[model samples]
Target: MKTHDLTSLLEAMFHQSKEMILFVDRHGEIVYMNAEAEKTLDLSDYDRNQFINICGHCMGMAASGDPDCTTCFLMSKEKLTFQVYMRTRYGKRVTYIANFQQIDPENNISVFTLNPLSELMKQQEFEHQKLLTQRIIQAQENERKRISRDLHDGVTQELLNVLLEMRLFKYTKDREELDEKIEDSEEMLSHLLDYIRNISVELRPASLDDLGVEAALKTHFKWLQKQYGILVDFNTNLNKKRYRPEIETVIYRIIQEAAFNAVKYSGSDEIMVNLKEAGSYNGIEIHFEIEDEGAGFLMGAEPKGSGLGLFGMHERISSVDGELNIDSEPGRGTKVEGYIPVGERIV
Candidate 1:
């Protein structure tokens, strides 16, 4: 094609392009901008000569607290293509993948093109959520393995030992010896029963399924007191009110994890838990709070444990359309609060 026709075609493409395009001269003046650029930058009303510095349109450069002008790629000699955050006309921050090229090396003229990163950012967020889901599944598997190992090694092995001893009773000749073996067997059987019950409760409390969440939690608190010597002040108004199995399970697990965290790390002798109904007649919700006046760590700092407990709690609560909030500050205390809708008001 002829040079004139080729130039015309190129100009038409540039003018019609959706991507923001700018031509800047050596003096940092925006000599030309396409229709998209004018709309994106909110520069349609401004005189072209007056909009001189590119930095004026960038959030990173214009930020009052942490101006990032020193890292601007335009100052570098090499042709650059990278992501940047810019401020639009309405003061909204927008992400863009920008391409900068020296159009005329002798004249020190450059062309800057920006592709909006909104869609790309959304894709990245989706990938991140997928990774988080995978990690949560892996954590659950690990927990199941640990519980399985405990049951096999501790409970199952002891039961096997009792069975072997019972088999030896058949060969006993002395009545007295047989009586003594019977007594020993009874003692071992009792201990084995307790171990089995403990394991069963750990897997899932029968009280939770048979009785309700309140009873299950009370029993768990009593056990926690015996095991960890930490006192739990549990307050609830449910009065054995039953919910859907999934909701009860999610609430139980969250509170269980929260209480365990307090016992393990809070360093305080007592923790408080509250469960009650909230909202007016139109909308009712169940809210729970676990608070400990103990040694709380920084909110955003690295966790002391595997970090899966809180994450798992969040996942479980979210599954029930509930919201969870954890607040903590070093040397103060920690509080975990959550709530879920229980449908319309019963009263």
Candidate 2:
């Protein structure tokens, strides 16, 4: 085939593509764009002189004022291909897998081909669901571990001592001596049984069903104080005492996760938790905040967690139709904040 024929075929394919495509000059000015690019970007009366900066719009890319944008994936000329989100002229935000290549040798002009991020968006949502499921399973496993430990170390050991006493009573030759040992053994066993029952209830309290979020949090925080000895400055101002069961469960779980993370990760000595109506609205909102003078990290970078603690926290918060915000800086401090809307419930 002739070179002209090949070029025509390539142009035809480019025009027919569903993804947006554009070519930029040495100064990042738009020089050429395909049909799809015009349609997807909703660009008309193309301004060839306008510079293309991925951070200039609704894209997740850092804005001009952003400290990290200087070293961002969008501005890095070294990368030949990468993925990023961009805002279109139509004002709709989208993620795009973009390719940049230096095609012009003399002027250093480049070509950029972009594909829509629909697939990635779907994948991210699916992963979010999977993350939530994993979190629930992990929480269940952790509860089982605590329960098992309590049974083994507390009740089970006490019962074993009682059993030994019972055996001694059975072997005793004197009736009076046998009676005293038997009574003591019976009392010990009874106390052990009660201890095991209490442990079981703590793992999954029946009161959670009979009571509500406030009660459940009160009990959990009491345990938190006992276990960690950290003072939790907790306050709840509510118009109602109870909420939908699902909402209550979500708030309870988020608080539990936040409190646990604070104790485990935050080196600070105090934490504040608040629950009340958020804003000028009828909806009840619960806020769980863990503020500590501990080590913090940059957002969007990988979080330091033993397993899925951070992931699980995010998942649980999402499940409740809530938002989780983490603010931290190295040696400065860390804060985990969760907001749950009661009227707009999520499970």
Candidate 3:
């Protein structure tokens, strides 16, 4: 672009851009402001010829602390881009992303531009959710791989062995040999059946839909003890209560993941799980917790294992308008707890 055209374009943008643009001196005296700035800010407090107190309109530039004017933006010579809170015509303190740059060194005149913080946050949230959705899809695919491996390595191999044994039964030298082979194959097949059943439960148990969250969890805790020797002390006052299918699934899955994490990482032999109505008068939500007095970790430290399990638990709970909170400290017990609102409660 030619210099003359570039100047015209810049002039048009100064008059057209919706951002609150202002020119101020090093002493924070407002020199010039765009039409947009005049429309948004409450300037009635300051007279036209008076050295303006920009502080009245700007609450403060956000800093590491409480936006304290410790390091005033106007006092600095370097250009800066930061978040700032500014009062508007309606006396509302709205956050704005601000840019301050010295345009005239001799005069100490700087151009300040302000854009609403909400627009940036909305864009960032969209990107974050997009990444999260992709990760969840990957987690589901990994789960499928796990189930497939278990069936192939444990159940399918055992079944194939049984088939080979049956084929050789006709060639058995005597009745005693055939009888012994038959017994051995029967035991092998029985174990394979149990293994398959375990995988099926891990995928999505029918009991969760047929019975409810409480019953499903009881069976799960029992299985955990049987399979991993990790005892789960389960207690519940739900008393055969029922809920919407989706809500029940979310509750069951969140508890399941938490208990599994405790078993895998807690190093403690026992875990306690509590399930009950949360509110005293209304009982409008259900609260469940999985806790273990084990070797807990720092609250913000890196996870011992892949953090996908914890992330998935949060996603599951959030889908049902629930809240999940985790509290743990080194040498202190870890507790994974949450509440699921029960608007779809069924008797």
Candidate 4:
């Protein structure tokens, strides 16, 4: 092919390419940009002759928030490729993989190319959701296995023992022996009833269905005090107000998990739980908060447990269009708050 034809073909390809391409001068001004570059970077409004520093669009290049022009690829003598975030004209931050090449060394001209990272980010988000689903399934299965073991090893075995004792009653011919066997059987039956009740409470307290969330929480806190010696200061202004079953369940579970985490890891003697109504006029929102003045873990650090508890809480809350916020710091305390919009209430 002739040299002129080759140059024309390359120019057409450059303008038609999806990636944003810019020709920058030595003074960091954008000398020229292709069609795709103008649209992607939202620079169509700016005149090409008017100098615009490229660093104004950068989201910093070092530890600080200020853009570091010294480390910019355009200033480097060698070619460079790296990831960077840029603020678009609409004020949205976008990630891009950029390549900078010194096209003309004598004239100090460089060509910069940028490929957006939106698709890569979407793929990552999808993979994260898949992992979350797997974790939820595993948690459910583990809980079922635990319940099964408890029933078989504890409740079922106890019942079998009671049955064996009753079989001995047939061999007892004396009235006194018969009376003694009957009393033993009665005591065993009573114990078995208590065990079953405990398991029922563990699964889902009957009070939660019969009364309301407040009553159920009181019962749970009382039980916690007796079992783990952790006192819970419970407060709620809802005054037995009822909500959709799904909302109630999500709030209950989130509080349950948060309180359990505090008791298990916080090492604090007391925790606080508060539930109230938030927002005004257009909508009503239910806000529940659990706070512990105990030893809290560092934010973003690996949790001591399976890390599924918080994840499950988030999943459950979000399912009901609720928001969950957790605040904690080492040697300080932890607070978990959730808000659910329950719509306008009837007067």
The top-ranked prediction according to lDDT is 3
Give a tens-digit lDDT track for model 3, residues 42-151.
66755554426567688887766466676778877664679889888887878889888888999989888999999999999999888878877887898789888998
The candidate, 2 or 4, that scores higher on lDDT is 4
Ranking under TM-score, best-scoring first?
Answer: 3, 4, 1, 2
Off by over 4 Å in 4: 1-68, 78-81, 85-93, 101-112, 277-279, 283-285, 344-347
Any residue pairs clashing in model 2, and if so which? none
Compose the digit string of candidate 1's lDDT tens values, residues 215-292.
999999999999989999999998888888888899899999999999999899999999997785657789999999
Clashing pairs in 3: none
**lDDT for residue 56 in candidate 3, whole number 0-100:** 65
Candidates 2 and 3: which is better by lDDT? 3
Question: Could you give me the TM-score of model 4 versus the true structure?
Answer: 0.77
Error of 1 at 159 (Å): 2.4
RMSD to the true structure for each prediction, in A, is: 5.3, 7.0, 3.0, 4.8
Question: Per lDDT, what order, best first?
Answer: 3, 1, 4, 2
Model 2 stretches astray by more than 4 angstroms: 1-79, 82-95, 100-113, 117-168, 237-240, 277-279, 283-301, 310-314, 317-325, 329-347
lDDT per residue, candidate 2, 48-113, as tens digits? 333243234324442342333344543444454455566677676666776777777687667778
For model 2 the TM-score comes to 0.61
